[model samples]
Structures are given as structure tokens and as C-alpha cells.
Target chain A: MKPLTTEEIRAVIAAGKLRDNLFKATGVFCLALALIVIVALVADMVIKGSDRFTLDFFLNFASRRATQAGILSAWVGSLLVMLVTAMAAVPLGVAAGLYLEEYAKRNWLTNLIEINITNLAAVPSIVYGLLALGIFVYQFGLGQSILSAGLTLALLILPIIIVATREAIRAIPAMIREGSMAVGATRWQTCRYHIVPYAMPGILTGVIIGLARAIGETAPIITIGALTFIAFLPPAPLSTLGDGSTAGLFDWVMAPFTVMPIQIFNWTSRPDPAFEVNAAAAGFVLMAMVLSMNAVAIFLRYKMRKNIKW
Target chain B: MQIHDNPTLKAEARNLNFFYGEAKALKNINMPIYDKKVTALIGPSGCGKSTYLRSFNRMHDLYPGNRYEGEIRFFPDNTNLLAAEVDPIEVRMRIGMVFQKPNPFPKSIFENVAYGLRVRGENNKRVLDDKVEHALKGAAIWDEVKDRLADLASNLSGGQQQRLCIARALATDPELLLFDEPTSALDPIATGAIEELIHELKKRVTILIVTHNMQQAARVSDYTAYMFLGEMVEFGKTDEIFIKPKDKRTEDYITGRMG
Candidate 1:
């Protein structure tokens, strides 16, 4: 059939090879582009912020006296708020996740709930800020306190935790359930003893990732009316956000609190040259916290994959 | 011609009918699983042989839209399997099973066998160590994998994995071992090894195996039950079932005259 000219055959082969080549190259190109973008972003964040990384930046709270100020209060505030959020949100989110993925009956209500959760996950952090402002501050009388802000952040990130938990649960094979049942294990035992242990790493990874997102958030805490300029190192303890006064519940409701995002926002906007360096250093510290959480997540993921059996 | 009752005819089914929604899967299954004797169920694919076997422990209970309209009873000394108060979990503990695929829990080899012992609440390390070794030896895989006890079971070969599953089931020290096409997923060499193990196993425990391999049914089982279209067509001594089956259908199946 190819008794024709060599050049023509060569041309035809080249065209076919090029088409096949392009088909395979498309996926590779997409992957390469993704890697390049990630590298570029990390490089940019590091260059812009890391040079100014300092200990004093983490020790002293923001001061009106620009040249001497650091992100101490904001750092402490962010850590406190996130810890509280993690404490409040993780258990509830994971429990809800377990119920939905493992125990929920396949009914209309569950379907509705699942759909709403997905939509909630898509809701902008800005909307959560508005939610914090209206219900938490005004209606519930929580005001702009760290407690109110933490509740807002918890609500914002709970959907992510649930979704991640569900995925982790789903990754467990049906055979494990069957095998457990066949060996006289109760349904609860199958879940609690066999299933949950297997799903732990994935769920942990999800929580760490969700926390990273929560810590990096700015707009929602802003809407909660977190103060940008709080000279005090949180009043309650190593972790209190505002004045730490739940004053008679109602008076307590009408108090002001500040968080890391507000401090970052406040620092980033100041009209001073030295304050900008503190902002970058604070940014660096913020990046470290998020990256460390991510590292824990990555380690958990590796352990999970290594330990997972067929 | 003779169906002798060994004292352990502890588990018995009388006119049991299993239906999957609208489709009848097991029709009037009247079988007696004798104590301490291997009774193998052999049939072609889709013959409801596994269905009859699964009915013994009600393994299909978890599946939706499947119903049984007849009785499966256990002995008084053994407790009634069909009793309303009877827990399927307890029944499962009594009648442990191994599947066609080698399903090792994503655990260490030692942990896999020890899983049943642990579930049964035998936590003593010495006891676990002994039981693990005993069960492994019983399945004829102990010598091969005895050293790699702490390694992941997924690292084992197909045959070794299947043997490990058998060892795991055996660790519970169940009265009956239900093997659902156990060797179907194995190579010829592995299949032979498992068959030899089964021959050795029937000496102590009741082994009920389901297989499409007619030769295997003839080779391993002391008593063989032939099934087709959800019905137990004929059952007798393995030699008689293969050589001189009373029913024309059984003879047809054995002689390759029919499926």
C-alpha cells in the first residue's frame, strides 16, 4: 500500500506522530504548567516576605509608634482564635461527617442537607463576615469579640472538614465492612474499631488543611469587627482574643476583639515605611503557620498511604 | 444411598427458599451440614451454590430486597440459627468464611490472623502468638510466612494471601469453614496446595466449599452436593456423585453432557 514516494510516506507518518504526540503532550503540559505556577507563587511569597522574618516581629504587639512595633499581639491572637476554632469545629465537623457518610439513611432530608453543605462550602468568606457582623455581634450580642469571630470562622470552615471527612470515609473499601461483619463484629465495632482507624489519617489531613485556610482568612474576621490596633497582649491568658470578659453574658456580648487578619490588615495599610516591614514579617510568620499545618497534613497523608493495605 | 447423622448435624436447613427481590435464588434448599465433615457444594456459574452456602450463616442478610421464606435452624446444643433472638454476628463467629479473592485486611500478617482472636477478645500475647502460628500452620502457609509476621499482608503472593485469609478465619476456631470458590482465583499450583490443605482440614473441622471445578469437588470433598438452577439436584459420596449420580441431570453434568 505504501509503494508510493518516501517523502509522502514520511510526511504522513510525521503528521500522525505529531497528532499522537500532541495528544499525550497535552496532559504533560497541563501538569508542568501547574507545577510552574506553584513554584512561582511560593518563590514570590518568600522573596517579598521572608527577608524581614524576625523574632521581635513575633514578640511585640502592634504599637501606634510605627518604628518599634511588631506583630506580637496579632500572632498571639491568631494562634488563640485558631486553637479555639479547631477545638470547637473539629469534633463537631468530624461527627457530622461520620453521621452523613456512614450512618445517615438515604432519605430526602439527608439529600437536602448534603446539597446545602456543598453550597455552604462555596459561600464566600466575605458572606461569613457579614453573618458574623449581623447575628454574632448585633443579634446574639456577641459584638466584635474573639469568641464571636472564632464562631464565625468555625462555621465558615466546618463544611470543608465535613467534605474531607466524608471523602476519607468513602475511601474505605466495602470488603473491610463485610469482613468485619462476617467475623461477628457489630456495626458500631466495624465503624469504630476498623473503619475509623483506617480513615483517621485522611480526616486529620483534612482538618490541618481546613485550619490552614481558616488561619489565612482575612475578610470574615474583618466583618466580625476584629480590631486592627489592640496594644494589649490579649487579656484572658496566652490565648484570649479581646478583654476576655463575658461580662454578665449581655455586657460581654458588646465587647471588641482583634485577630491576626485584622492586625495584618491594619499593618498592611499603615502610612509608615517601617510598619510595612513588620507586615511582611507578620506575613512570613503567617505563612510559616499555614505551611507547618500543611506539613502535618502531608506527613499524615504519607503515613496513610504507606499504612493503607489492599 | 446413606445420609448418616454425625452428632454435630448442628446446623440444618429445611425447605429453605431464598429470593432476591422478584428472582428466586435458592429453591427448597434441604441440606444438612454435618459436624466435623467436609460437605462440598459444586455447580456451574449462576447455579445458586454460593447462595445456598451463604444461607448457612445468613451472610446475605445485609443485602437489600433479599428475603428468605423458609427456615434455617441450628441444633439445640448449638442454638437455633433462625431464632429471633439469635444474633447473626454470633452465627458468623460459629461459621467463619474465606472468599475467592484473597482479602487480607490492610494489616501486618500477624495482625491479620490475630484479628479474629482479638475480636474474640483473646489479648494475651503468648496466646495470640500461639494461635496465630497454629492457624497459619493449619492453612499450610505458616512455614512460608512465619518470619514475615509483622510485614504487610498485601506484600504476600496471591496463594499466600488466600492461605492467610484461611488462617485468619481459622484463628477464631470456628465450627465450620465456608469456602466460596476459594481456589477460583488461584493458579494451578496454589489451587493444589489449597486442595491439599482442605483435605487435611476436613479431618478436624467441617469444610463446606463451593466450586465450579468438578474435578476439585470430586477430589476434596468427602460428601458432594450438586446444584443447578437454585435446586440441590443430587448429593452423595464423592465417588458416587461423580461416577454414578442417581439423577439424570447430575450424571449429565458429571459426564459433560450438560452444564
Candidate 2:
């Protein structure tokens, strides 16, 4: 390298330093802008609904009036629907993932199956609703029920669950499996005893993320035509099929029922100005519910992480 | 001449060939792993020693598209180890393997040792505790881990972890044990401890060890097999191979030739 005079050195250093600083400043500005947007959005949501968030907002049921209305039914309905979705989806989705990751051959057939699953994940929520109506409701005579709606949403989110589960399963090293098998454990036993336990945290995180998407979904459940008004607790001793089109006490899972988002949508659509506040309050409820669910998920993840030996 | 004989063979590899796709990693490996002896597969790096050790227990099949051909039998029945109907899982239980690095599961030290037993469906706590103690003692780490059994296995030092792996493998009561560069990831002290343990273990379980450390092979092994580029170069008693190897290549390898 040629030795440079002081001025030449200063000029060269100045050019490189300025270029580096300019890029650094741009990165800082981008980060600041993103933070500002997040804070502003959260501030707005809190300001609008903070006044209405009384204990009753979480405690009581929905009303047609703005001032007196609470989101109890919607909250309860959402819980029932979410629990139903979790009940239906988690095992099936995880099983599909296990099969794809551990058992599925790396042939064109498996590739095609994987491709189709990816496509299914991308399909619009409303399209799932339509499919649910035609196939689950009219075609299969499952009817417009909470169970049917939960199943519909489950199917909609299954692709994501499977993909995430596969990712979790894939994260475990081949060494762990071999180590287990080296001790003479069968393949299924190895997975059940070793791989699944190790992969559980990621699987739970993925399931929670998928469930979050399902919770926020409105179009499909609406398309499944879950009822907007029901003045009773969901069936406690639940049945599996047929309670939507024609009402019967025994038919629990297949019966049509409303969820929080659907109820919120119904309230928000009303011409009455009072229902508007209720909808906003319902938004708060929904957000709080999602936040708590997320908190639980985060807690589990932390525990899983803390508990892992490696 | 029949160089090694056993009342009951711990393992036998007959014309064993291993391929990672088309590249042969081990070729025509005909050897007897005698019962209750430390049989070290020693050679220079990339000399198919580890490959041969892994092939004995079918650890070679873990990766997709990797293939193994020819027969590997286990004693005393000389079971057809290569038969398609033979479950590799069972073979693994009978012929446990330890990797180059100590790999304990992300679990309590007690649980790590108990993993093999758990897979065999042992659920009684007292039995598990007894077996864990037995294994830990067998691997020469019972005093170190007998108290803190609930602690994570990663908390153990390098040599301890390797011993824990041995204990875990031992918990399965394997007929033969394979060590694939077991001390390669360990320090000199840890390596010495492991080498000493391996020497003692030969009284009970047959051991097939792969080692790059020439001194380690010479110190610990009863019989030695030399391999080069996936082919067996020499097979003889440990002293004969190290002190006066018949093949020039084996002598060169023992004396650091083209390796």
C-alpha cells in the first residue's frame, strides 16, 4: 500500500466515515420510526377503550345497548370455541407434522403433499368459511354449529400448525435420535421418549401462534354462520354432532354458536350509536384475552427452555 | 492363522461394506470382536475406523441415502445382524455406541442414565434408582453423581459427561459397547479416565473402540485392526500391530507414514 500524506489520509478517512455514519443513521431512523408507530397504535387503542374497561367488562355478558352492554357471552363463547378448536386441531396437526417430518418419504408424493399443505395455509379465511358451509354444513349435514365453526377454523389453521410442528421436530438433531436408538429404543419409542419431549417447546409455541390466528379469525366463522345471539352458557355436558340447524339440548359440538369476534362484528354493524362503545370495549376484551393467552404461551416456553438440559 | 478367538463372540463383521451414497467408507471388514476384550480400530484420520465402528451397531443408517451392505453378526448366536427383519433398535440395545463427544440428553443426570431403562419400559422408581447407581458405578462416576442426580447432565465436566454417556449406555446392559472416538472431544485428563474405564470394562462387556490416539490404542486395546481409505490394512494382536506391523502401510500408519 502507498503511504499517503496527512490531507489525503484525512480526505479518504472522511469519505469512508461519512458513508458508514450515513447508513448507520438510516438504520437508527428506521428503528425509531417502527417503535413510534407501535407506541402510537397502542396509545390510541388504550385511550379509546381505557375508560370503559371496568371489572364488569370482563365479567358480564353482551347487551344490545352501548352504556349497559358487556362482553360476557362473547368472552364465554370465544373460550368455548377456542377450547373446541384446540381440542380438535392440536393432536391432528401435530400428528400430521410428525408424519411429515419423521415418516414421510422424500419422494415426489411427499413433496406434493407438503406443497399442498403450504398452499392450504395461504388460502383465505373466507374461502375456508365457504368450504365449511358447502362441505361441512350443507354437504355433510353438520349444520351451522359452534363445533362445526371450530372444526372449520381448525382446518384453516392446521396447515400452519403442521408446518410449525414439522419445524420443531426438525430442530432436534439426528444425534439425539441415534443416541436414543443406540440404547435399543424403537423408533416410535425414541420419538415418544426423546424427540417429542425435546421438541415440545417449539411445538407449543407453534400451536399457540396458530391458535392466535384462529382466535382473530372472523370471516370463516361468520361464513360458517355461527349464531350472533344466544342467552345461555354453552352446553356443559357436550355432545359431538348435530345441534345447529335444529335445536336440541344433547347436540352440543355440532350446534351453531357465536364467538367474540362474530358477536363484536354483529354489534359493530348495528345502526345504534351505543353498540359502538360496546364494540370498542369488546375489542379491549379481545385484546386482553389474546394478551393473556400469549402470556401463558410465553410462560410455558420459558419453562420449557429452563427445563431443557442442553 | 486365526489371530483372535472367543468362547462367545461379542460381535462379528463379515465382508461388511458401508457407503454414504456411492462413496465407500468401509470395505470388506471381516473381523471378530471377541467377548470381554477391548478391540481398538486404530488408523489415521479418514481411515474408515470410525466408519467400521459405527457400522457394527448400524449407527450408519441414521442419515438418509447412506447404505450398508454385507453381514454383521452378533454373538453368542451369531444373529443375522444384516437381515432386513432384524430390528436395528434391538441391535443397538445389545450393541450400544458412544459418539466422539459426550452427548447426554437435556435432562437430569438421573434421568439421562435412566433413559435407556425407561425405553425398555422400567417405571418403578426403586428399580430405576438401583440401575442408575449400578451404571454410574460401572462407568466409575458413581461418587461424583450419586448425590446430584437431579441436576442437569450438562453441569458435569467433560470427562464426567463421557462417563455419564457410558453409564447411560451401560444402563441398557449391552452385550457389546462401541466407542467412536470417545475421547477425541475430551482433554488429556478426561481421556485418561475414559481410557482407564475402557480397560476395566473389558472384563464384562466387549468393546470395539475407534481411536486416532496411537498411544491410547497401544495402552488400552487387547487387539488392534488397522484400516486405510476404507480397506483393512492389518489385523493382529495390539503389540504385534503397533511394535511390528506386518504390512508396510500398517507400519507407516503406526509410524505416521502418508497419513
Leading candidate by lDDT: 2
Best by DockQ: 2
Model 2: fnat (fraction of native contacts): 0.78
The positional error of residue A253 in candidate 2, measured at the CA in angstroms, is: 3.2
Q: Lowest-scoring 10 consecutive residues by lDDT in candidate 1 chain A?
A: A246-255
Candidate 2: clashing residue pairs, number: 6
- The digit string of per-residue lDDT tens for model 1 on B1-259 reads 2345444675677888889989999999887777667788987789999988887777887666678867777664656676557778888988889887888888899998998877788899999999999999999999899888999999999999999999989988888889999988899999999999888887778888999898898888878899999999987778888877899988888889887
| Per-model lDDT | 0.81, 0.83
In terms of lDDT, model 1 sits at: 0.81
* DockQ comparisons of all candidates to the true complex: 0.62, 0.70
Specify the CAPRI tier of model 2. Answer: medium
Q: Candidate 2, residues B25-109: lDDT per residue as tens digits?
A: 8888888777888888887788888877877777766667878888888777879787778877777878888888888888899
After TM-score superposition, the amount by which residue B155's alpha carbon in candidate 2 deviates from its true location, in angstroms, is 1.4
TM-score of chain B of 1: 0.94
Candidate 2: where is the Cα deviation over 4 Å?
A3-21, A59-61, A238-255, B1-9
List TM-score (chain A only) for every prediction: 0.81, 0.87
Model 2, A1-310: lDDT tens digits are 8899999999999999999999999999999999999778656657766666788776666665566666666777777778878988899998898888887768899999999999999999999999989998898888887778878889988998898888988888777777888888777887787777888888888788888888889999888887787665565553333444443564567645778887788887999866766676677678778888899999998988787654
lDDT of 1 by residue, A1-310 (tens): 6486999889999999999999889989999999999778666656666655667656776778765677776777787778768887898888899888777777789999999999999999999999888998899887677678778889988998999889988988877777777777777777777777888888888788788889988898877778878776545423434566443523322345566666767877888766766666666678778888888779877877797877
